[model samples]
Target: MMNRRYVPDLPEQNALSEANFLRLEKLLGGLKNSHYDFQWFGRNNEPVQVHAEIIERFKFTSTVNLIKQNSALPKPMDRVQLTIRMYHDARMAEVVTWDSGRQLSGVYPYPNDRMYQIDEKAQANVFLGEWLAHLLRHGVAEREWTPS
Candidate 1:
């Protein structure tokens, strides 16, 4: 799965890249029903484990035109916008506000309040795995993802 970091710059691609989106479309189109295991640590410092099955995977167009698109409105929000064609399966991807470096947000699932409570490294790993699994489920190839 191509990590969000490795995804081509969205502005450069305009709306969405057909090649990458098509890759995902073809991959998910083949799957019937399959549960993929994912693991992570919790805010209480415990392990979070779950299995999400592949129901359907497809591409959708979304945008975060400005930094404030991430802002929580009432409060300052820190986040990163991953522009790509994504899926809507059993596990719904959510907006996660985390403190990767300076307080930042991401298009995964996590909250800011507990950001300090969870094991950052472990959670990051788990998040990465889930992100990768989502990509692989859709047949997207893996690529090195680095923060900008």
Candidate 2:
């Protein structure tokens, strides 16, 4: 592996990203307003709320914000907040910012400044996929529920 070069697996990334678009749509499609609230009893039957909002919209793209509210998970996981850009034209969504952090890069130099994983971008997307799937799997849409 001395001479091996890093290459972005565009195909795999594309597939996961594309699938995430669908997952997002499934999560956000039926929302009656710009903001949506939901609840899911995950992990020890504790109530975890999810907040989703359409933060921006344009001709062929939209920005969405997702956050876990009242989560019982540990740090970072419990603080999962993301602003995703949905490319309607291309039919996929990618995380633009995580936890309000800097713009996510597709690849990072190993042992870099932030101690991030090499495939941070891809991992973000995958994390999003799992989050969305969890929302779809267990979330119950709230029409007028308030966080408590």
Best by lDDT: 2
lDDT scores of the candidates, listed in order: 0.32, 0.83
Task: For candidate 2, give the lDDT.
Answer: 0.83
Which pairs of residues collide in candidate 2? none
Candidate 1 residue 44 C-alpha distance from true site, Å: 34
lDDT (Cα, 0-100) at 29 in candidate 1: 42
| CA error at residue 22 for candidate 1, angstroms | 23
Give the runs in model 2 whose Cα sits over 4 Å from its true position: 1-3, 30-32, 74-77, 144-148
Candidate that scores best on TM-score: 2
Q: lDDT of model 1 at residue 108?
A: 24
Tens digits of per-residue lDDT for model 1, 1-148: 8733323243433222333334333433433334333344434554333333333334532211111122222234223322222333312222123322333322223445544423343343244334444445532222222222
Clashes of each: 5, 0
Query: Which residue pairs collide, candidate 1?
Result: 78-104, 78-105, 79-104, 79-105, 80-105
Please, what is the TM-score per model? 0.22, 0.88
lDDT of 2 at 53: 83
